[model samples]
Target chain A: MMSLRLQLGIIFIMLVVAGSIVHFLRRKSIDFRYALAWLFVDVVIIILAIFPRAMVWLSQILGVASPVNMVLFVGLCLSLVVIFSLSMSVSRLADKVRKLSQEIAIIRKDVFDGDNRVREEMNNIKD
Target chain B: MKKLVIIPAFNEEGNLEKTILDIKENAPAFDYVIINDCSTDGTLAMCRRHGFSYLNLPVNLGIGGAVQTGYRYAYYHGYDIAVQFDGDGQHSASYLPEMAERLEETGSDMVIGSRFITKEGFQSSSLRRLGIRYFTFLIRLLTGKKITDPTSGMRMINRKLMEKFTEEYPKDYPEPESVVTVLSEKHRVTEMPVIMNEREEGSSSISLGNGVYYMVKVSFAMVIARMKR
Candidate 1:
């Protein structure tokens, strides 16, 4: 079982991290989908803090030296997941930007040419 | 069949006019569009002044994105055949009709213009040739298809492959990777002997400094491309 001071400390840090994440989400500084991952990590830590006895039992079964090490290991895994997701999002956004730029260039050419076959088709329909 | 020549240009202000003229003289049966990839030079102005059919990308998309944009344009315009012609004055337009003819005669989905086949005209530097040979060997090993000049920018694709290219293409140094994609799908590919000219203006995009990166990235991409099926 964790001491009262350690339990309070863990809860305090996690609450503060969750608060900042929510604040950033509200302020639109970060995307909700991305912020949610951080919030999830914080929530897992808070749950572990609330149940230190459970963490100690699980750590023993998993061969961890201490409950704190167990918490750190879990946090590391979650952080890796978040970071990998961020890389995926970056690649997706780059692809989207490329496609958008290509489309915009084509549209600009259609507008510049003033001989849009579509416009001709529309006129023919009216006639 | 409606045919389109895709000329992807970047800061080719000195060479574009002549390249377009070469197309007009040699491949008059086909229409052409210049993909001006946000050239900081007078390329855009040249397109405007001559009233050339062009799509000016608002940003630089390197060679692959620029060529993919041309494929999209070809797809939307309903071109039955799409020819990729360089705007650097290195690729002669005279081979375009022959390429298209071979594509029809052999019923291949893609046709590559290979300088090594003829051993004629400006064969790139010895270092570049060695690099090409390595790629040729790698691709043949992976897909069992020989691509004599895997780095040639001049090629023609039928409507089916043109549509495929519109959906996805490599972002940089895409030639060898794209060939792998097509060949891995068990589609037919052909190569025609063609003479190429030395570039009259502007520097080649692939410099010696990043040659290693180019090889590693392209080789990885080709492996992934073959396995993507």
Candidate 2:
């Protein structure tokens, strides 16, 4: 039986892969930069998932004498934070651009449709 | 149909009422919008007091950002023709109809109200004139469009071009920079000769020091605009 920590890492990796697949299916238009970012994130999670013994080797190399599981857990936690921050930033920028475009479209429609009711209101002030 | 004029005002409480009245008097068929660029002054209060249908920007996002706000407003509000009228009381409302008519006849994306096109009454400083000439040459060399008055803010934009502007507009001093942006998007932009008056009150937002900054910002924006897709 696998250690509890190793089992959690495997489950986390599975969740990420499943999430990425769902995102890809929904968007249908995935650019290279985002693809590369997700690829790096997924690869790191997979490495931590499959090779559980490699954690001991990494801990020894990093001069951490604590149990291998603790070292691996800390490393994985740090990686998760960094990846999540990066993904959030990219998504935020994308959202801003999308919102800007939508706002522009709405304004264009109003202009062409002759909805100058505001002007009429202003004209009423002349009385 | 009535014309929609977008005047992006940044702390121009002194001049806003006059400019607004000028449009109302001279071009009654036209409606105007004032985009307040987060003025700490009583500009917003004045707009509210006068009951002008204006947009209040949350932060001070320079001239280009403010103008883009006006374009976005014009795009959604339903106007036959959109004109960029300066809030400094420099642009006359009388010339608005001609610009709008030209846009309708020629099907051009944008029609600039130009002072450089004719020797008829343009009294700008020599330094600004020199800068305008340099930008005009740069535009011709790059976009193959023989355009003058690249820095003139008084312009009439059609629905199609207004839509493009609302989508994505340059963020710094955008007059010259946006000419290239408009042209690169396969849109036709031209200039018409017009009389330009000097500002009656208030100083310009951009200082002499900002001239160098403007050139660098425009250069980068031009490069980005040239990119395909």
Candidate 3:
């Protein structure tokens, strides 16, 4: 069982994290998906803090001798998931940037050169 | 045929003038578009002064993205052939006509201008030659085809392959990976012997510091590309 002091500390820390995430969500400074993920993590931690017996049960099911070990295990798994998602976001962003830059360059060349032949080329792309 | 040479230049201002001049002198019939990949040098200015056709990317997309941009231009402009001509002055424009002719005559999807076929011109540093040999062997093991010079920047592709390139191109050291891609898809790829001049100025993109990383990335990409349908 978690002592009251420890549980209070956990709840206070999670509250701060949740507050920051919500603030960013309202300001639109952070992506909605990422904000939601952070909030979910906060809620999970809060639940474990509030019900230490739940953590004990989870630890038992996971074959972890101590609830502290279970907490570390969960934290490690979540971090890996977050890192993988970040990699995916970066990859997608790079692809979009490359495509947009390529299109902008071609459009600029057509307009800058001022050749109807280039315009004809633009129309040819549509075909 | 509407052939367009795609010269992707990144800080190659010193070498670009001669490359374009060579193209004009040797392959004047083919149209060209210089893909200025956000060069911080005088490459764009030189292109403007010379009145050369060019596409200036607002952001630097590296060699792969720059060349792919040219392929997109070739695609949108209805070009019959698109040739990847390096702007570093290492590749000669004299080979363009013969490469395109081989592409047409042999009915191949792509034709690569390889120096190893005749062992003529500047054979790269021995270390780099070893790397190219490894890739050549790996590609053979995977695709059952011999690609003497897998790293050659001088290559010509028919409209079919050009269309494929516009849709998607490998962003990482694309040459060997793309060759595996085409070969896996069962495209007819041929090699034409050509003399290549050593890079006139600047340096090759793969240098000593990142040589190992380059080898690992390219090898992984080739194997993955080959495994894909």
Best prediction by DockQ: 3
User: For residues B1-229, what per-residue lDDT tens digits would candidate 1 score against the true structure?
Assistant: 9999999999999999999999999999999999998899999998989989899888889999999999999998889999899999999998898999999999999999999997999999999999999999999999998999999999999999988999999999999999999999999999999999999999988898998899899999999999999
The DockQ-derived docking category for candidate 3 is high
What 10-residue stretch in candidate 1 chain B is worst by lDDT?
B51-60
lDDT of 1 by residue, A1-127 (tens): 5688988898999999999998988899998889989999999999998998878998999999889888888889999999999999999998999999999998888775666677888899999
lDDT of 1 at A16: 93
* Cα lDDT of model 3 by residue, B1-229, tens digit: 8999999999989998888889999998889999998898898998999888899999989999999999999999999999999988888888898888899899999999998989988999999999999999999999999999999898899889988998889886899999999999999999999998888799888899999999999999998898888
Model 3 deviation from the true structure expressed as Cα RMSD, one decimal place: 4.2
lDDT of 2 by residue, B63-118 (tens): 77778777777676676678888989889998887888788888888999889767
Error of 2 at A85 (Å): 10
Please give, for every candidate in the order listed, the TM-score of chain B alone compared with the true chain B: 0.99, 0.94, 0.98
Show where candidate 2 strays beyond 4 Å. A1-127
Q: Flag regions of model 1 displaced more than 4 Å.
A: A1-7, A52-70, A115-127
Specify the highest-lDDT model's number. 1
lDDT of 2 by residue, A1-127 (tens): 2477865876686677757755885697665555665566566656655665665666677776654464456557766776787789876775475456445534544563445666777789986
State interface RMSD in Å for all models. 0.5, 6.2, 0.3
* Higher-scoring candidate on DockQ, 2 or 3: 3
Ranking by DockQ: 3, 1, 2
After TM-score superposition, what is the CA distance of residue B21 in candidate 2 from its true location, in Å? 1.0
In angstroms, give how far residue A125 of model 2 lies from its true place. Answer: 21
